[model samples]
Target chain A: MGHIVEKVQEYLERIERSSINAYIHVDRERVLKEAENLEKNEKLKKRPLYGKVIAVKSNINVKGYLVSCASKTLENYISPYDATVIKRIKSQGGLIIGMTNMDEFACGSSGETSYYGPTKNPRAEDRIPGGSSSGSAAAVSAHLCDMALGSDTGGSIRNPASHCGVVGFKPSYGVVSRQGLCDLAMSFDQIGPLTGSARDALLLTNIIKGRDFSDSTTVDTPEFKVWDEEEMKNFKIGVIKEFMEVSDERIRERVERAIEVFRDLNWEVVELSYRYIDLALPTYYLINYVEFFSATRRYDGRRYGYPIEEVCGEEVLRRIMIGRHISKKEYSGKYYKRALQARRMMKREMLKLFKDVDAIVSPTVPKLPHKIGEKLTPMEMYAYDVLTVPANLCGMCAGVVRCGEINGIPVGLQIMGKPFEDEKVLNIMIGFEENF
Target chain B: MVDREKVEREAEEIVKRFSQILEKYTFEEAEEYYILEIKNVLREDEEPSVDPSFREEVLKIAPKTRDGYIVVEKSRWE
Candidate 1:
């Protein structure tokens, strides 16, 4: 226990010196007191995640901490209670280290949209850490925390994980309770884990997942099954053509090499295509606009820190305005309803494809993360999520693992499975990670 | 005293943006799509007990409070 406290202190020291801007808030005295309390408890060794330091994305509540969602709208707002996931982690002996930075209201693909500052990619300091779970991925990559919780509403977890060269898992929708998470898109969001390895991600996911009375969307999921070191032979992996075609040539090559690694292990690699895959990004963003607008109506300056429209960052404002416009009774059917139809079509297509293949694989992003302040249009930033949004659109479980590095920058290989097949996705990720 | 022309311009702009979004997904017009995944998970309608001090705790964080009530701007009608 003494050594664990010392290690945590050391990590805190490193965080103080770090320039990545990964954390929006850290309460040193409170963290040390919690660690000291754990040390005094003799039964600490019996608990899972004992002495593990877990960073939380700012959108997820940790009692008494700022759950700002990296926005000025909630800058001074303190969480009155812990999110269900935070409670689960703490109960399992995990220490809540700090709140990590993210895109304001989880609206951007790049980390630059954070009100705190952009979370620089630890792998490449100049490049943006892909977001909206930017700091969680960056902190794990820099070894500032053992694990972190991040919410994925259309690739928030996996995108940053891809850029930072760590493992991130977005469990099937409703697999993990979203009780205290600040919603991005309620229908698309799921709280997930990002860690240095798939095994750690799985361990954390198991602790946090299950039904919660506070979140009615949560379903009764089976107890998480640990994966045996099974051989990769005979597993059918589908290579999504749409993902490859949109990806940069270097990224595509790296992903192809990763697929070849699976092929070399005697697994069947099948090249497959979903015809309407290009429609995923537009559908995903449309849904995000509507849901985010609804979620933000609560921050009208009376209850929260400030009025959202008055203080939110540019990207956040853009989504809110668009969301309000689209949700108008006269225009709802034209944009919002049409997007929902496309979403259903995507889910149907994915379910049909899963019947033929055990899992789908692709490069996590279409292009490498650009320089931290690189000038990119909103549309260009949206394009970065082209390859990662389909999983969320279809309500499937997906995991991203570092596949290869191009010019010292990491590329992530995404593996996705049908709903409630989270364990299978993690297992496949574990197999690929070990082989790589 | 309705500004008919101004209202018409705003309406046209909204429709233009909506059309652009629809075109992005290759949808000429909105189509009815059933949400197949939703289930009505209704729980028993019973009021659960809450801690007496919960109100005090919540009020402590409100931006403006007076006499145990959250204060808000008065309505224009009022």
Candidate 2:
């Protein structure tokens, strides 16, 4: 317990000295108190995540802490109550270190859009940490915390994890409760864990997942299965051709190396393609705009910190305006409805592919993360999500594992499985990690 | 007199622009698409229990309050 407390204190000091701007708020007193309490209580020692320090993305509420979502709209807003995941983590003796930064309102793909300042990639100081779960990924990679909770909407968790070289897992939508997460796009959002390893991610997922009355979207999910190395050879893995086509040659090479490892293990590697793969980004953004607009209606300047339109960053404003335009009564059927239809098409395609394979694999991001402060158009930034949005669009489970490195920067191999097959997807990730 | 032809032409233009955006995602041509079965989960009809201090707690964070109620700027004519 004493050693764990010392480690927690050391992390606090490291966070203080960190230049990445990974954390938006650090409640040092609260962190120390929790650590001291854990040291005193022998009963807490039996908990699975006992004395583990966990950083939470700013979008998820931690009672009495500022859940700014890395935006001025909620910059000073103290959460009124603990989110369900926060309650679960605390119960398991996980120490809540602080709230980490993210893209403002989780609207952007790069951490650079954060109002607090972009979270620099710890792996490459000059490169951007892919976002909107940027800070959580950066913190985990930098070892400022043992694990972090991040929300994924269109690759937010996995994207940053890929850039920072850590494990990020987005459980199937509705598997983990979304009650306290500030919605970026409710239909696409899932609160997930980013950790240093695949097994740690599974441990956090086990604690945070289950049916929650507070979030009716939650369903009765099966418990996470322990990894069985013997079962690894029996599964078929699909490599999406479209994903490979869009990725940089270096990234593709790294991902192919990972696939080759699986092949050597006697797992059959199949080439698959989806005709609508190119449409995933547009479809994802369209739904994101509409849902984010609907969700942010509560920020009317009275109940929250400020009117969102006036205080939010540019990317957020762009989405809201686009949402407003698309959701107009006369335009809804043409844009919003069509996007939903496209979503359905994507889900169907993924379902068909899953019938022939245990899981699909791809590069987590099509290219290496751009240099921090790079001037990229919104569309260019959106392109970063091309390979990762399919999992969110189809409401399937996805996990990213550090596969290989290029130019000294780490790349991730993405594994996606059918909805509610989170355990299988994670087990496959663990197997890959072990093999690599 | 209402310009019927002009109005129809403008409406057509708007539809054309919207269609172009949808086309970018291949949604304009998608014929077969799945619609999820959305069933509303209704709670039992009963008087809801409330905490006695709930209102006070909510008001604590409201930007403006008057006479124990949230206050807002007038946005419409009576």
Candidate 3:
């Protein structure tokens, strides 16, 4: 009967009518009750996220909710406790709307690999909504929620955010606690926001970030600052030559057009070449395969859901198998160790490059989203992460904001900032969003 | 069912792709790099009290469970 409840009801109705398959679970009664309580709870209204509804990526635990990770491996698994991020959100009065669909165990790039089925792009109905944070991005794009939480292990957040025409951010590693996330890779995974605007992303980031005792990887970084209009100008944007060349022509044009906004503001746009960038995918996937294999060994079916190898989708199985092979003692140095060295080199390269430029700019994804259910080879799917993986590899902050559309489907311009300079990446995004 | 042979073939191709990169680049021996300096934070020795309801929740999700205990297969060691 209250306005808050009425508004939430409208969203729930839209979700019910939506064919996007963005959410895997929505406890309608619980959500409405929370909204109703928000109307009466005066103290809660004073909190930062009082009226905001959040959709969580299935990999992150929400107490008493099914945390399926979009895989049959834990299809019926209920979370016994809230993840640290969820605790923070609740403490700030953020209402969790539902669990969103994703690439099974956050393994796929195209969102179609979920056991529940792919999340349809709300912006481009027939095409894939990029993943493994598929539903979080789609939910925001479709107006199903004010914002969503997504786990980014090599662009899971920004990839889908770009495809769905929303803002998705991957905070610098160790900036946000990864405590309750069913991690894809411990070394790479970060939980971040998918929202309609850069400011909203910042608001969510501020709430979720900081040190937590439960997650030893967490760091108490300096608070992020909101940039003034004048502060956004006179910065250099480094356009990686490889990122541009690897993109489709139309996407390249859109990205070029997006860069002109910075140029118009008198920001110098420089071309920076990193030849080894071509190896980004293989290096990322090689590390990913090994870590994912190690992480999934816990789901042996006796304690949780089905054994992962028995019920997981093809992509998950592929990563597991490759991870197993590379982790073998005989092959360790040849593959996984080599990839680790490459990662270190890439990290050093990023540090050197950032010395000259404030942020690196590129198209968020190399190509536009392919049609849903279109069969892409494993290599082809992995190639989608080429531009975004470097940030994770080097532990840099990155964000995607829609700059323009290619044939009515949105194209995102990715801005990556130095590690812990998340505010700078966000401010640049905010600057572009304001000027665009 | 997972096709082991197909996965192996795919794995070989992927490994070959990266192997070429590794072969092309040479690096001096360097220590492993982690994002942060991690240390084992020790706490005061104490027994962790288990909550009964929380224990029940854990048992509930187990595919196989006995009275208040998760039932896992016995090891094959002699």
Candidate 4:
């Protein structure tokens, strides 16, 4: 009991003196009150997440806390209710530490888009924390919280996890509920965890994943195959040829080093190619623009804090305008519809490739994190998500683990598995952690 | 309107590149495939259950509220 109280106080003090800008809100009074109550209750002490401090990304709803989405449009608004995941976490006695900063509306790949300020990578102080889920990953990396909740729309979770050198898992789409999460692209949005280790991610995932009456997209949890040392020897791993072609040589060397870990264990490693991989970025962005524009229409200065169009950052405005153009009655079939077709093709291509391999391995990001406030074109920024978005496009489970370092900066190796094969992906990550 | 024009120019460049890449593959004229197969989950028809306090919490977050309801300006047509 004393241990939990001491830990919470320690984190709160560190947060006060820190300049990473990882957290946007931390109520010292409420956090201590919750910790004290947990100390008093013997029954709560038996729960799995008892007294574990969790940092939540600002976009997710936590009752009475700000769910600002890192945008001025909802800056002053407090969450009216708990998200389904938050409810589940609380039921297991997990303490909500505070809401962390993020790329405003989860729209940018770099952490610099937040209205609050950019989150500096704790691991590499001058570099950007790869984002959308920037603060969640940085908080875990900095030891400000035990574990954190992050949402992945298109590589948001995995990208930052790579840059910040932590474990990030995007569960198979629809396995986790999205009832109270603010939408980025409804079809692709998934709430996941960024943690210090793979096992912690698995523990938190099992707690929050199941059928939810409120989120119609929720599905029954799938049965996971427990791993045996001898049985794992037979697993076949694939390295995507297209992903490697675009990666910086330094990142590729780190990926190859990770592949060597699998080979040394008598696991088969092969190269597989999917032709439509080049189309992933355009397809992903076209759909996201349309859906994000649709979702922002509700913020018209009536119900929410202010009008999004008037208050959002540049990237958010660009997506809205692009979406508006594509959605015109005459432009429909030319852009959005073709992107949907390309999406279907990408999914089919992946399903076919998965039949030959248990999982695919690659560098999580093609390049290392750049310095904060670096000048980059929109297309250049979009390239950071190229390797990670394919997993989301195909509705597959993917996770990132710190494999090695390049120039003293951490590099992540991404493991992607077939849909509903989240356990296998985590098992591969765990195996990598043990051996490397 | 100037911002819109710049946005349009940027959109054109992006669209042109995307179209070129998409043209490399031949797509079938089939219905778009959805990832999940489940249809909408319908609730049983019964008298609605409401939490009265929820309304108050919702109204509290609104930019404008009056007399226990959210307030909005009249539309341009009105």
Candidate 5:
């Protein structure tokens, strides 16, 4: 345990931890205590993530540990039980370094509105790390831990991962149980990994994911075949036209270059249109508002102790208000139902689209990171999630790969596959990395 | 006059929705605070929107209207 603590401390200094503020708290005492046993007294457990040090997003419960959702309301509250993912990670020998910071209630696309303060991009501290999984993204970029776990509810995880120039994966919904997730649009939320490499990502996901009884929504992945060197010869890939059109010209160019790499690998690009993706954000926010209004009743100041209404930051408050207005009596189904129908329509369209392409590839975020603490015009920040949110809304397995650099900061290419075909999507990614 | 109770009910639903996005609040309290705040907004708001017809609409919904707006019984908060 002491050895792990020393190693974690060494990583802290090496990563220049002071600048990023990725973690809300690092539980050195628990981690080190566990590490001591693993080193001298503990027997080797046949765990894939054994001896690996990973961080958890503040949203996930860590059992008797503080799991602040980066809000002052949750600041003093400690989790009484482990979230399913946290339990799996610990059982598999992955050590929890600490809970990483995030946007209050995972409301914003950019990491700026965290009550604990925004986490800066380790690649470029001057810029905002895309969020609400801002701290998880920065932690890997800084190598503070091997990788971190983050929740993606409308692109929170992938947006940050892309801006930070690291790999982020959002498994098909229900693949990773939501048993312990601090519900953010529960239907849209999924626990996923943010790692330095696709290899590490696969290792962590395989451990934490599976059908758990605790999460009634979870189901098993079907017999998905992995693409071996031989099978890679004839698989087709699709590029959503609207998604490829970057809001920034340079990001568009970067994506084109990454596309060329696929061309070099003899992969065919299937041009397709997913116009419904354009409505993804509005629909998402609508559904989120309705669902969030329903979900938050558990925190009535009496049971949860803190009043989220008083302590939660502005972004959260805005969503609450927006959701409130949309949920009026006659308007009940007007916004929320329409959004769900849109989600259904998009998912149905993509189901057909995925039939033709082995995976869909696009730039994760259309732009790179913006300056830290910079007041972003709301629309501008919202654009960061444009490329990623559609997948969440559509219930697809999506991942981001660091493709190239823009002014020394890394940009990522997003690859999404059919629902429940997370393994298929990841295998293709791993195959691409083998070529690299 | 707009009943604060109606607004409170709406606010409860709003807080309930906000809780979904955040899940920070438990189900009961979120519902309570939400409803109460909405009632408060109704109570304090002389007018809710900037639309020109808002005053007219209030008068139409209310028991009476004088001039361009609802002619409600005066209250301490108002």
Candidate 6:
């Protein structure tokens, strides 16, 4: 274990400017010394993830470390305590390496608008690492960390996981505690694992997920059994035609090929549709605007920093303004209440779709990551998250697996299951990524 | 054709809601950014269906307007 930590330290130092702009801070000595401590603990008490090095998203509080959220607002700020997920991972003997960079304040989809600058795609340097969980995905992909913890609010984890060619899981909303996460949105935000493999993600999630006094939203959840590679080949999966038809041909083709692999393993494929999926974006944006406005009050610049508006990115300002507008008396619940109703419709559609299948399958992203400094109008960027938002609005657990490459860039296949059926999604993802 | 009533209402809503944010930015910078956004919204060429009261309410949010163009507090000083 000490040897591996030494290697990770060496790699962290060697990767100049980072192949992917992943880490916010790399305490090389701290991580290595912790590794040495674990190596010397002769009586290991069966911690689920013994000595595994984990990179955490900056939003989740880690004691004695800065919680920057890739924003200038909290750059010098240090967390006084650990988040529920962090405490659990620590209890399980996981070594915390450092904080990963993200889209500023967990805003934006392309990962370009972070205060720490953008994280590049490790697979293709010019391309973006999709975010706001950009650094966490890049860290695992670059072998900087074994696994990472990231927050997913409207596909923050899964989007980057798809773009960076890794496994990203967003647990059943409210099932995973959010006590320590510097939230993007109270209802939609969740902390989950980004890893090289589904197995690691599942192991990490199980360690952190459960009832916590800090977050009443989390239930006393049990770990679900994920099927082994051979067992999932026999599973039934549904492909949302809405997802396949919307993506670029190369991306859709890669997902199609992945589905074929599943079929060759004897899995059944059913074409499914719930047409109202178009409503997810406006609904997602509205819910996000209102909640994000509410979540950001602490950043009045006095607590975290003052006058953050000067250093805060445009996307952050946009949300703060939009959220502020939504809270006014006139628009009260017009956009928000309607969106919730739309969410209910989405949930109904998801429920009906999941009735005949064990898991729903599609490319986690419909397009490959675009190059950095390449300008995309904000709406075009928002369009990138179309595939994953429906899963979030309906409160389903979904996993992203690096399925194939498009023009040499990676595309992810998303496996989504009914609410709280994260284990089922994880099982299918393990089977899906065996080829990788 | 661009519906003046619809544009007027959207303009008002922008000023009413964001006047505070505008306080941080120059009134012209905010109004330029805000008014242009309101005008740029691709409105359908249909008869106004929004409430007349809402239309009046929206127009009231704007600080000034004349000669078919929404006016703003000048930024030449700041």
| Maximum-lDDT candidate | 3
Each candidate's lDDT (Cα)?
Answer: 0.85, 0.86, 0.90, 0.89, 0.74, 0.76
Best by DockQ: 3
lDDT string for model 6 (A1-436, tens) is: 4665675676667544465768888776777777778767665447777778889988888876778888887777776668888878877878888998889888988778878788888888889989889999988898878899998988999999988888999998767889988888776788899999988888998988887755656666777667656655567888888888988998888888888877877878899986866676776777777788888876655433444556677777767777777778787545555555566656766789888999988888777788898977555777888888887777788889988887778888888888888887887777766753
A405-430, model 3: which lDDT tens digit per residue? Answer: 97779899999999888989989988
Per-model TM-score (chain A alone):
0.98, 0.98, 0.98, 0.98, 0.95, 0.95
Model 5: CA > 4 A from native: A1-6, A12-17, A41-43, A222-227, B1-78
Candidate 2 residue-wise lDDT, B1-78, digit = tens: 224444345434433454565687644344322222335645568888665665776677778898999888776563
CA deviation > 4 Å runs, candidate 3: B1-4, B29-33, B42-52, B76-78
The Cα error of candidate 6 at residue A381, in Å, is: 1.0
DockQ of 5: 0.02
* Consecutive 10-residue window with the lowest summed lDDT within model 5 chain B: B29-38
lDDT of 5 by residue, A390-425 (tens): 787777889888878889888888889887779878
Task: Looking at model 6 chain A, report the run of 10 residues with the lowest lDDT sum.
Answer: A300-309
Per-model TM-score versus the true fold: 0.93, 0.92, 0.96, 0.96, 0.82, 0.82
The sequence of per-residue lDDT tens digits that candidate 6 reaches over residues B31-64 is 1101011122243477655334533432333335
Q: What is candidate 4's TM-score against the reference? A: 0.96
For model 3, what is the error of residue A353's alpha carbon versus the real structure, in angstroms, after optimal superposition?
Answer: 0.6
Model 5: fnat (fraction of native contacts): 0.00
Which stretches of model 4 miss by more than 4 angstroms?
Answer: A222-226, B1-8, B29-33, B44-52, B76-78
Candidate 5 docking quality: incorrect, acceptable, medium or high: incorrect
| DockQ comparison, 3 vs 4, better candidate | 3
Give the DockQ (2 decimals) of all models: 0.24, 0.16, 0.54, 0.50, 0.02, 0.02
